[model samples]
Target: MTIPLVTVTGKSVDDKVTVERTGFEEILPKLDGNPDTSSDDSVNPLERGTELRVTVQSEVYQAWGSVFEQRIGTDVDYDPSTERVSFTLDGPPTRGPPITRAAFSPRGTGTHIGKFAGTTCYRPTGGSSCTAADVYLKSANDGFANCFTIEGDLVVERLPDSGSLYGSPGCGGAVIEGQSFFGERLSRSSAYEIKGDVTFEGYTNIRDRVELLEAGGGVHFKDDVRIDGKVKKMRGVTVDGSLYFDQGSSSNELKIGDGTVIKGDLVAHGRIKVSDTVEVHGEIYTTNRKITESGGGDGLVDETGNSKPSSEIHKSHPLSQVRGEMRRDLTHMITSDRPGRVDMSAKEPATGDPAPDLTGATLDCDADGTAETCRLGAGTYKLDHLILGHGDELELDTSGGSIKIYVEGGVEVPKNAHIQVLGNNPNQVEVYVEGQGAGSDTFHMYSGSGAGGKVTTPQDKASKFWVYMDPSDEVRLKQDTSFTGVIYGPGNAPDGDGVDIYLDKQSTVKGAVVGNFEKFTNLATVKYDATLQNKYALAAGGAARGQVAYLRTSARVVSVDS
Candidate 1:
């Protein structure tokens, strides 16, 4: 595709140049490269002045240069020492990449004069987008004002002592086509709206209103955050630290991770899962589903069902609210009325057929490796059965890409076996087991007398790991084995094929384990990471539109008398 270019020429020494668009070649040398080559190819390169200073009026800019005989500008000064010379003009500022967008870093704390076309990221120092310590958006005519909408992501990272994002009074708002991130803390009086997923990595003090219009990826806060204004229609949010939501505000499917605290009143349309030792300073209000507290003696608390303030929590059976919700969600995935078909009258074997012979099975590691140690590379492998004995080391390497291990029978990772994941990201590995027809799939992990080896992913990529089994399967994690990932099985099937998850004594799950029925015994913990909902949603081809539609189904309006 041909890119239309704009040229800025100085009539005299006192005149200045203004760029109304994003795609413009560099007219003057700002660094080591010659600027004269960027001028009109028909004009003589030597005709342009040798030492010239060109001031840009846009927040984003891109310049292309060609070969020239002599030197262009001898001395050029551009702020932000980490700026690069070569940049691509993606498209017009209103449009994204593959068009006329300019790829130049804005320097100084002054007003920028250009617009951007594609997703723009500003890091401290990188080739991607803007990464300045402090960014100032001046008058509507300056900075990113000319661009009505950013066709891509808009990320802003702050320096250690940097302040909040500064915008002029005339700045209406910003529309980002992709995700938006603010690395630093914002003041209590700050107000803004984001169309994509928003993340706040630092301590954010929220006093004013902040709206996330289309949070398809969900909102994440890594540190402490307090919301004083009303947050309406937010879905799938995770707070690593303490979260304060004002009274009477509503959200959907909120998960509070481990070691976090929640303050103020919270109303959710979906499930509200809390982890061990989490302290809720205020009451929880659920409009549709119930609240499940992991590791705590109080089991599932249904805010809509029994109104005795609380009910006898049962760990063996699924929460009444959860059963209904799961059935609905599973129905969306499976169409048949008998979604999970398994005969309840048929007698099933307690254990799977003795591990099938490994004669034709694909081997991931060398045959010479002893039961104590083994190594596996990333790829797709089909196995009849997978057995990891005690003290055995199974290293799964997925640095190249994601690894999928499909087992046709059962999987047994006995106690004390070391399962180390080489990749730091959890999304790098997936294990699927297609058990022997109905009610035969089994994942057994017996407890050892002492501490067993852990099956965990790196702390940062904790949510990437996944394990999928048949609808009617038995998954048991016993005695000191820690797992950090998602375990997805079938929902309730009264006629038979219901999944059962048993977390016995000292077992801890950092992510989620979804099944038809779950039982926790002797200090077992299930810390729900709410971000996984969004991750799983995206993985299932669900759009990350931020808000939950079900919560907004019934709307009401009331007039207040002044």
Candidate 2:
């Protein structure tokens, strides 16, 4: 290809010129190299200009049937810092059909600007596409390009290759706007590494092990993938589909959303959220990061100690109390007449009265039997292993103190059963406290006597203790059986101090009842449909069998004539 010859000279101050397009020889001689010798003959370079360097402002430069096209303006100006032949073209005109390729060393003194051969061809499939990177190597037909490296920011709207992108170690790090290298895999076997950032809005599938020494953006897998190396550290490793980490590969910061199925142990130094069911055969440990659900729901700990669904809760400041209080104050509630005065600590000590020394004492009901007309005084009591029956009631009139009730046992209160205290009426009750073993002092039930109603203590003041009730016989309840008390852990009397109440679904209970009363935790075998197995069921707020109607709370022999 014959080169174009054009003069490049600016005399004095009046030598400003403008042109749309021209050849390299027209401007090269005017830059700083040679003024007389043409830019095409490869003339022995001469001191082109002694004073001001000639400047050519043109949008196009052609040589040997090739054009270096620029978009807006091409202004050649003298930069005092470099004092070299310098010009700035507002980049190449967008990106059209690749016409030619030129190699130029932007810096360094005697750097050679080599000319390499290349093909300027477009994709036959029009628009743009890519290939999933595998393990093969690909190269452009550029003699100087295959061995050279590209530094600085190399932006590409899309780069679709069907082979591996091999970069010399000197390529340093090239940032790609889009992520997935469709058919071309990136191979760093030449000791070259991606030391910069790779922002992929798509999936990254590695046919071989990916050893990332430093990466800014997180590795996102938009589809199913298998990684083969240990992920040192990543911002957020998201697997939109399933992930199969090879034998030795592990992820550090993993964010697994719904539709993710992982086949390896995921170790994270940060929080991990899983919105779907996760089944892992490997161990998982979160040292400090809390696991939660991305979508909203109550946080629960499954039987396997795995965190259930819930939103993320940020950690509060350390060394501070991070607790949730379950308090509901009703101080402004109306009164149904102040309770009548009952002098429990009177000197006369009436018969069938609960001892005043029962304060700070514990009471427990028997598992095998029931306590009829049993009454208890105020005390910090632990009620366990017991069945309370026959109008059994516990009343407290202390001031400025609350009670703590913890029951691992079952409790029940029949209809119309009186468990509260009458104005001055009291009854004999047996209070039992379980032994904490050793000589820790156990409060035994009234096993060898008629009835006991006093509090047992090891000396005078007692702080911590348990209560074990005496084994008694059965306590039956007719209809209208009212008991104002608390019951826990339903089971047979021979089974220990737990209380069990068998009620038909038609029975009504008026007292506040909590805990699973259907004796669910005590069965030998659990059925698929959660059968009570001839156990008990409570019916409150009017419910009965056969009649489809509820019983009224008023006192009467409300008889069925049939």
Top model number, lDDT = 1
Query: Residue-wise lDDT of candidate 1 within 1-562, one digit each (tens)?
Result: 1223344443443245443333334443232232233444322222221221233333342232221101231223333443423322111111011101111111112212222111222221124443211111111112232222333323332111222222122332223343233333233344344333444445444333454333334445555554434443333444455454332333433445433333333433344566444444434445434566666433322233222243322222333432332211111211122223222222122222221222355333322335556655655556656666666666766665555666767766666665677766433566666666424338766657746546766652435566666656777777777776666554343233345666666666655554432444445554444344235311311111111111101112322221
Query: Which TM-score value belongs to model 2?
Result: 0.17
Regions of candidate 1 where Cα sits further than 4 Å from its true position:
1-359, 362-370, 425-427, 437-441, 492-497, 537-562
> What's the distance in Å from true for residue 326, model 2?
45
Per-model TM-score versus the true fold: 0.34, 0.17
Candidate 1 global CA lDDT score:
0.41
Give me the displacement of residue 453 in model 2, in angstroms.
99
Taking every candidate in turn, the Cα RMSD to the unseen true structure, in Å, is: 27.5, 43.9
Misplaced by over 4 Å in model 2 are 1-196, 201-203, 207-216, 238-240, 248-562
